[model samples]
Target: MDPHNRRRHPTTTRLPYSLGCHACRRMKVKVLYPRPHYRHSLIGSRQCDEEKPQCVRCTKGGRMCPGYRDANQVVFRSVNTEFIPEAQNSHLRKTSKSGGLLIESISSTPLLTQPTERWEAKAIGHFLYNYSLAPTKDSPGYLGFLSDLLSKEPSNRQLKSGVLAAGYASLANITGLSHLKRSAEKHYGETLQSISMALTDPAEASSDTSLTAIILLQMYEVCYLREMWQSFHNDHSQAISDITLVPQDPHDKGLVELHRLRGNSPSRTAAADGILHIIHGRLHFNSVGGLHPSRIDAELAFEGLNISSSQDELWCIMREMSESCGKIRAIMSDPRRNMPESAIIQSFDRIFAAYLHLLRWEATQSLTRSYQSYKMFSREENDTHQETFPYKYHLFKHIAHGAMWIGFWCTTIYALQTLTRTSSLLDVQLLSRGWHQWDFNKRLRDAIGEICACVPYMMGDVDQLGLPMVGKEGKAIGSFFLLRGLYVAICVEELTDLQSSYILKTLLRIAHVRGIKLALRPRSRWFAQHGIAT
Candidate 1:
């Protein structure tokens, strides 16, 4: 038999050898396999010129030529035959052809997969690794507490599910992945169901895991609301009620205290020592001084502060200024009698004096010292900022600056609002003389500018600044500052339409990017009213 015929059998088929172009083999089809326009110099074919635009043969044949593949292109093929690399094949024992090539000889053994619980544990472990220290010292630190609850024997399923939900929600925000958000929603639903069921059993309902789970559920809701606009339902009220039934641990007591504070009901001791005394002092001053006190001890104390004072003294001045604001508000809101122009002017002078004092105190402090103190405190508080991630320090520093900025902001606003109301009650010419000296417009602009400066810091981007290592506390604090600033900026009549819109949009972007639900609702409302898409 001929050599080619000997290689063929009844079970196999052979095609006649033809020197075709590489494109034919790549396409692996018989019909028009060697396309008409394909440039190929077959052994028996005519040697046609391969020209750009179109080959000579293709042009003569009136066929469109498809482009050719690159010379260095690599194609991969699949085969059932065993052909291990020489470096790896040396370990195999020599054997008969059938035995050596058998699929079983080179096949890998099936891996024993871990159970679902182990996999869940692994995922939970990963989440804790990232978020275990996320909460600040002042916060409840529910994530850290959840880590402990997950590590316990038998495990708290409700709490674990809540943690998983919150973890995935946080991850979704960080990564901006839809699948993780969906996963978070699923686990959140499961957590709610579990908590409802657990509530039936008294022992289970009052457990720390149950309480932590409730807090985590709240966090999950916050994350969910950040991405979408929804009505502000008080989900936390029900949780607060449920918390009353729980046995009082330190965490539980703290929750109860927070619940009371948020509910506008101060603890009896705090009321006695703090707010009640302040109210009493304000009332006493009003009764004696006839709507405007000639001498307020708080205001006098602030006026006496020297430039060479410590932060503690400056803080005292701030407190005095804050109290003076409350007194001014009380005087303005008094329904008993109308305030005289003389009294209003006197009150304005006192408040304005305190405001100037604060400004002077702020000026005396070094920006470098403030920045350094902020960095040092932040590094001490958050572990995420240690070595691997240093930029997070700026975010925390921004938050610290926010706290100070808010103080200046509130005082400036109070002074302006009080002055506006007082001016409305008096002859414009009479008050204009006093107001012109203060430059209220300039003061308001400066305050708004300071708040705006905080925007880049809060958003975790300032020139070549580091990425934010923002955790729950940072987000909450930053959102609060921005929201307050937005409110202040929106209320200012001095701002032009374009200026207000710019501030509003920038705030909206920060809220959206940071997943701040509280900031989102008001921002979305403003956007809707102004014909801007959220």
Candidate 2:
């Protein structure tokens, strides 16, 4: 019964054979039984019975059997020869009579194939389609720069793993696939490990590939990980801080060099800045109750860029907003630190300037403005949207224009809120003399109305005018943008009770439909108008 010294046996039954068990294959031990017509006979192979549980030979010899490889391991190519690019196919033999080639799929050799699993492929594909760069630069989701870098450095395991992790995590959120979620967590852990290992080496850690991987991991966190968001945010900020503080050789740019490594496209650079700012702008302010250090870095990053498009202008407004916020936070937090009314007035003036800029900016985009218009439904015309979407319904030329418009209104409201906060510190008569001409309350209400008007369009629901809404390729991208604006609108004190309730309801619908779990849990302040606390 010794497996190492098996004797040959003769069998007449023409039972088909397969590849051997792990142990047998490793030891070069084959089935002692003979089959003259075996598939692998040309390679002088012996038969593997591949019995259930453990194979008979391994059991008889007290050897542990890992079992045979699954049938999936050995794939057969179709005899019908349709040529495809980058595909492995069988050899062809030319026929003398017809001059046609015949596929020789009868060979025993296995062709090399893509090693990724089916779910992994699906997750990666979904992530790329939504986030990758569009043909035009105006597209909202602009993570395509990561793909460009990935193409160049195919050997960067950490970057690739992080991309897959983000993909898997995002797909899992959308589909509620338990196995995909588990796989996402697995890849996420591996990505973190890879990043950790890479971080130990200064050159590798500062490389563009490494930074891209970290940013991808951050995307996974922002989209899905609610509980870990704060902790991870702090850790990520600290990591960047540590890297930035590293003493650079006089000849080396260090932090500046790391920024340069982000790639050549301004939109790519701006996208990265916008993402970081969003993570900081949204989460950190809630958790830490102050301006995040990374927000400062984002602003500094913005300073280096030249504005070429509306997308760049949007980032510029955001940068200006962040700067205003920092000044207000500093002034309000420390009354004794300075005694300059002019400085405080200047902060207020800057905010109003940014507000004016946003207004002018939108006004100047005549084409985008023409395509995007709003209609307020009357009581007689109101139907189901009467309660769910009682506000205006917006129409757009392109999804990008709609997003920009929503972003504009959201920034307008943000500016109004910031101005109010800043105005509280100074004497009302001092600034209100000139600024009071602009109906701040009406402006606030109008901005909120515009955001509400656009939600149905953004969410792919039909407008009040009976026009079909365009569903963009990445619903998640639209969801994120709407969530940001709506979250702000619902909390505005100027919003009516009915409007606030409708916005909350829309937020809930987005959570269920878009699968962004964060949307489900609104902050306690969001429900104040309903007299309900979190």
Candidate 3:
């Protein structure tokens, strides 16, 4: 048996031995999509190369897309991988194996240009590792036949492209093999350690190490989010002292304009002066305070700031209220969860107001104008001309971030407002009024409506919102986010200390049973639009 036929792992594709197989040329199919020219479409196609686009199968099928089954008839085979150094050692090791970049490589040859079967094999390994829909395997088939047939000397470079492809595959939620997470993490960590050097000497990072870092980073993020939710309940007790909050730079959230109206920073004042005079032609309540009151409406950006300021103030007030009643925060009293449902709803109402203000500010800045959800990036990733929405949901981030921010922000506001007064620590306000009067959910719904109205227009649908798209879909999803905000408000505030601690776990159990979870690469971006049925 040829040692070349032995596989590190048995997959589906096999490599070539001894530079043989004349019909390997016949099997070498150049797969182009609707367009005959593959090179031209590489740069022009708005959809990602990975995304199933309008290929010949779909073009011929008419109106319907080619499903995964149709992918089989697509007819393509990647080359052998594994022994990268042997191929790179020679000029013949140039072409790539699978995926769009593989297609791309054919047009642009590598620095070395002895186009031989070795290069084809190693390139195939890189492609299968990076972009193969299935995990790379050992076979004459696309899955695993390569390691068995292709014979070459050992090369670390061969693994470079392949490892990165593996990362992309994993991140996109396709397991080349049913890899154990902990084992994958451990093995992947070695890749991370080696890749750390790449940060200092980035050029040394071939596609392999760079991709490993990205995947590792993604894993870290996923783990971190999960831990955050687990630990978020106890967050109400986690305090941010007045001294801790570094007076935030306005640009931190990319917030604009209000600092100038208030005349806080010298640099901001300078920028404001020009923007007022040149951009809006109005400069009254700012440095030059003699512009007509009638001209106040002229500066759209400033008006947005004014509204945003009010919202912030509202959030500050609500945060204080939630802190006072939160099961985690109300620990001064025993059993720790004496607050009623009404109080929680009231807190939510104010928080909802704050969220509305944030959205307005975002809209004014043109941040949330076109974005739909972070989960779904535009098909035209390179199209810089497009304007996507900035994701700032009803004044919150992940549940834990929201909790910490509210806690942190409210604590600061409380300290700032009460600097002169001292005895107000235990003071509780019993509102005779009801949550219905405020009805902040309605306000949140409207804000969502405005954001949704912009999505279709961004998606190139200029007509009003409609079903299956954004109009009805938008309302349903928008209301869903609004509901979630309310639910979090409920979760954070309506609990005993015991309840707060287990609140997340309990919700997870319920959600698990009800199947109200986002899929593998979960995101909150679509949460609002889809109402958790996402």
Candidate 4:
């Protein structure tokens, strides 16, 4: 099959349906438009371009101007620079008010491009910029033109995704504890605005929007929680002087999760919940310091799980899941989770479905259905108005196998704040090219395997043009799977202080050859940390 034909297939939206193939999947591809090269448009020189792009602003005063001129040529030449200004394609010129020669808008948003698989590296840049770095105004798709390309009368030549997603990611990337705190606050407002939009869309709204809104709200909640803890820390300097640390039990099986995933049964001997047990036992960073008494209440109440673990530098390989009831597991029930990705992406759709039910005074019924683990007993009272969905909505089964992939990305972002450059973090599994250690590489491969496995489900037939699962409803199924791959690749490539950048770059090269959507959120949380307020 011709690689180009695969780009427009509908099956691309859902994960694999029946068989799994070892294929290099694509996430996004960016095509940088060439400059007009007309004397006046000289932006700046390459050396001065990293902090400032060579745009009209930099070239305002010409040769005698203080800053270097001819800067916008780009610090690196990676995209297809060949210009095809042939007469037939001239319409693109009129759209941009130039000779069909328009510069891509500079927004901090990471926009995915067609044949997305090609630009895997950019995705990593986005992950690092959005989650690891401090916030800056331009840190997130600071290019500024990304969001404008997503409407009814979308830009004829504009290329990118909406501002919110990319912008939100950027705010997460900013560095510095103090600076990060402020970026979170400012972004909280933007997220609040998105929330407001979801609240009003009675028919236009679906499970995806509502859930994402709630998650964003939670992001704010987390920031507030951190602020509260920081305040407490400032007020109680000597409260933890006598903290007693405990050691994890070497023999504890009942403490394990109610049911182990995939394998293991009641009779199977299991490893003690050592991770949890040890975490609970430790009282201080160093044994000499002992443990703080204030944390004891928090610790015991946590039932062996530590709050610090939430902040633990996230590693790709997990022996067992953190309380199955936490975030990712909690989100699997989202109505949008069942919805197709092509329909419209609602990163928090699961949460939205739950919120809508809550709004109608049916919080239990709503949240119950949306909760993946919410198991209710069959009762005669089941016959209620609860079964009905507004004319615009339908009960859709959210994809499962695909979600594990998404879980990985969400997990990565959440972990970035935790794993520091010096922590005993093992990020080698993040390698995109391939790792050689049998066990470690196996872990990474398993994650990628799940992602590629879902491709058939999203797009359906490798031969079909329209993805059957997506249908005319505007939803695509496998999006979560692909995003997961992008998320992990991005983190491994750029976010984590991983030493092997080349592996991810190579994986992206494979994506380009295979033809997948390669995209990045240009404006990330980093800029918010660097330039904006919380």
Number of the top TM-score candidate: 2
Q: After superposition, how far is residue 297 of candidate 4 from its true place, in Å?
A: 14
Clashes per model (N, Cα, C within 3 A): 0, 0, 46, 125
Ranking by TM-score: 2, 1, 3, 4
Clashes of 1: 0
How would you encode candidate 3's per-residue C-alpha lDDT over 39-67 as one tens digit per residue?
55654443222234444333443544433
Per-model RMSD to reference: 22.7, 15.5, 21.5, 27.0
Better of 1 and 4 by TM-score: 1
Q: Write the per-residue lDDT of candidate 2 for residues 1-534, one digit (tens) a residue.
A: 899889654323322443668877777665444334554442333435566688666776787888866544544322222222112333433333565656444434333333445455566667776555443444433464665666787778887788787777777777787777777788889888997898787768766666677767766764565442333235655433432231212212233445554434545454454433333333222211111212334433444332237656765676677567666666677868874778878887777787778777877875634454555645565455445455567776545556656666766776776676666666575355565524677778788888787776677675435466456333565666677677667657677777777788888776656656556544333443244533
lDDT string for model 4 (192-270, tens) is 5654564465432322223323322422332232212233234333222211122322122112221121122233211
Model 1 scores what on Cα lDDT?
Answer: 0.49
Winning candidate number (lDDT): 2
| Candidate 1 TM-score, true structure as reference | 0.45
Alpha-carbon runs more than 4 Å astray in model 1:
1-165, 170-222, 226-350, 371-403, 426-434, 463-484, 528-534
Worst 10 residues of 4 by lDDT: 18-27
Residue 17 lDDT in candidate 2: 42
Error of 4 at 244 (Å): 37
- Residue-level lDDT tens digits of model 1 in 4-35: 76753222122243222333334442312232
For model 4, the stretches where C-alpha displacement exceeds 4 angstroms are 1-213, 216-398, 404-436, 459-478, 489-534
Candidate 3 contains a number of clashing pairs equal to 46
